[model samples]
Target: MTNSISITKIRQLMTMISLILLTLSITSIAVRGFNWGLDFTGGVVADIQTKPDVTQVLLKSHLDSALSQDVQVTAAGNEGNWQLRFNDTDLDLREALNRALLPIDSNFQVTNSSVIGPQVGLEMVEQGGLAILACFVLTLLYLSYRFEWRLALGSIAALVYDILIVLGLFAVTHIEFNLTVLAALLAVMGYSLNDSIIISDRIREVFRAKPDGETDSLLDKSIVSTLSRTLVTSGTTLVTVSALWLLGGSALEGFAIALCVGILSGTWSSISIGTLLPRCVGLEPNHYKPEETESLQSMP
Candidate 1:
């Protein structure tokens, strides 16, 4: 029955959340300095298809020694095919690995060889970085148009916090920054926005229901009331993403893990960022509603 919300509480929560995000980002940078994967740093990758009778261990060993350079070999397609990779190709591990294979079976032709350059990868990084910024800008615009500008501003700030926190984790954990991982970040952005929007919608309902309402208290109650729904939705999403991470192989692992980070962050942001933000900024419910217009009397 308490329609009043406390603005002070909302500001406190926002301040704390902001600080937590900054700490997470700084700590992450200090720890690993962002692990740039071979794709970004420049390296060699070869897809060598061989006979079905080939064994992974035998192939790995053969390539490692014949090339005189360290290499990793794994089944490429079926049990018959193999993919070989070496870092910083100046040593020619590819030739060495191929030579090693000749002793076993020379027919293992160099089906594919791609020497990824740092410059090429750097461009990719730039493009990817731009795309992320674009998503945030668009999300901000859309939210502002649909709701109030304050909500829009708060939602974006929270999203940035979520992203920074995830990056910090990547930096701290030293996760490889590959194309797959970049894709994961984009996915998280979309997911986090969706979650925050849901929480915002609920808080709006509480606002219009009470006139002269305090936003902080209303937001808090709205958060509590929607807590069950939030958990249920997030829990289900986590379960699906968990399965992909656990069973989808390396190809999907990064994507799934990114979701795990993002979804968790999204849940937190919904309450801490989305809910508290609009209230903290004094985005009254009446601000969004169109004013009623009276019909003009016809010459009374």
Candidate 2:
């Protein structure tokens, strides 16, 4: 009993610490503009594999001298491989940098290098924003039809908050928001809403089951009853997502992390906010009568 209490106390403290850290991160990001990536801002990626002993600063120095333009170099992979992120949309600059850096190392080998054009990058940003917006609007319409308008509104609010929090995480972390990250964010929208809908359906059933239940109490009961299932489902999801996060490689890491965070938040809001919509509209779940559904029909 003592150990369990101690662990719980420790966990509570840890959670408080984490929230404080996140607050600090957001404040810092607000002070400093976002750390935009090459994908959104447009630039060239120069990935090179060289002799095992080559250093990034040396590579930067050599390339910087030869190209007559500045560049930021990131060392990736095992000791020999490196990735250079440069601020330019020039194919010629890419080729020149590759050619110049190759000779510096006895076994200098260019693995992959390319310039991402600004126009294409801008188009991707535009399309991604539109896709998210369209998904949100369409989901609202679908839930309104399948459930009730109030339910739809509640679920969408959670969805919007989930997405914003995810973006806020990204912004605060200063992670690279490439196209892959956008796809992950888009995926969160559907995944989050699906969880919300499940709870919404349950709330409707709860309202139906207890015809004389007060609306608030009924919602509370519905959420409390569904709590176990939500935790179990989210736990299972976290297992797989955590596995992916641990082993998904750099390509999928950002997306996986975003999904993991959003899923947990989605589950939380489904119980807390999603079920409270009817209560906010002055419906008492525990006191609900069978005609309560009809009452909602005339609510708007």
Candidate 3:
């Protein structure tokens, strides 16, 4: 009895915390919005090879002085290979590059230069939004088909919870919202859904195994049973993502950060929202039982 009460209390606390996070996420998105990156907004990108002695800071400083607007410089892949991005569409990139870079490298060369028009950016925004919407719809359909209505809804709620929290992290931090971060969001959805399904399956199994068990006690047992699996999966993924964040360079920084946040939030939502919502909606063992087949009355 004590254990059951404690578990119930923990669930309530976690639910409250999740609600606070969700509310904050929505509010931040509404007020602050996202920090759209060059990929989402029209901009100029140039790949250049700099002298061995030219560092990113040195190049950025020189470009900042030469160009009329701000320029962002990030290392591309190999040594002395750098990419530059700026929103000054009217500024002459070739002239600016020549003026600033020639003084330093003398042999610096511009390998590629391209412009992303506003129309293309807008189209990308529309398509990315549609992709996320489609993913949610498909997930909802699959979950509803695979489980009871209550469980399916709970799983969906958990997924939404994970996404909002991850998005909120980006919003609050003002991190660059680019294509890579968008990809991370989609990956988060898949990871969170997998975790939720595993817990839901365990819940159903526990309910069937002990039909008369108390709801809180049974749910507690189910969560406890899968806790190790969740930890191992999340832990290993985080390790790899952390490596990417540390060594993958500026290009992949946003992607790695998004994944890290998503993984942590996904784990939390799966353990709390995924299981608690179903219980709150009155999920019971009877919901999983086969329909009773009535015996035909004996002919009198």
- The prediction achieving the highest lDDT against the true structure is 3
The segments of candidate 2 whose C-alpha lies over 4 angstroms from its true place after superposition are 1-33, 46-85, 90-113, 284-300
Better of 2 and 3 by TM-score: 3
Q: Report the lDDT tens digits of candidate 2 across residue range 1-300.
A: 454345334434543544454466556557754556677788888777888777777888888877776666766868888887767665485467656676776566668878777887788889989999899889988998887677778898778767766777777777767777788888888878878877888878887787675555555556667778888888998899899989876557788888899888788656655655444665544333456576786886
Candidate 2 lDDT at 192 equals 82
Clashes per model (N, Cα, C within 3 A):
4, 17, 0
TM-score of each: 0.83, 0.72, 0.93
- Rank by TM-score, descending? 3, 1, 2
RMSD of each: 4.2, 6.9, 2.4
Q: Give each model's whole-structure lDDT.
A: 0.74, 0.73, 0.88
- Judging by TM-score against the true structure, name the best candidate: 3
lDDT of 3: 0.88
* TM-score preference between candidates 1 and 3, better one: 3
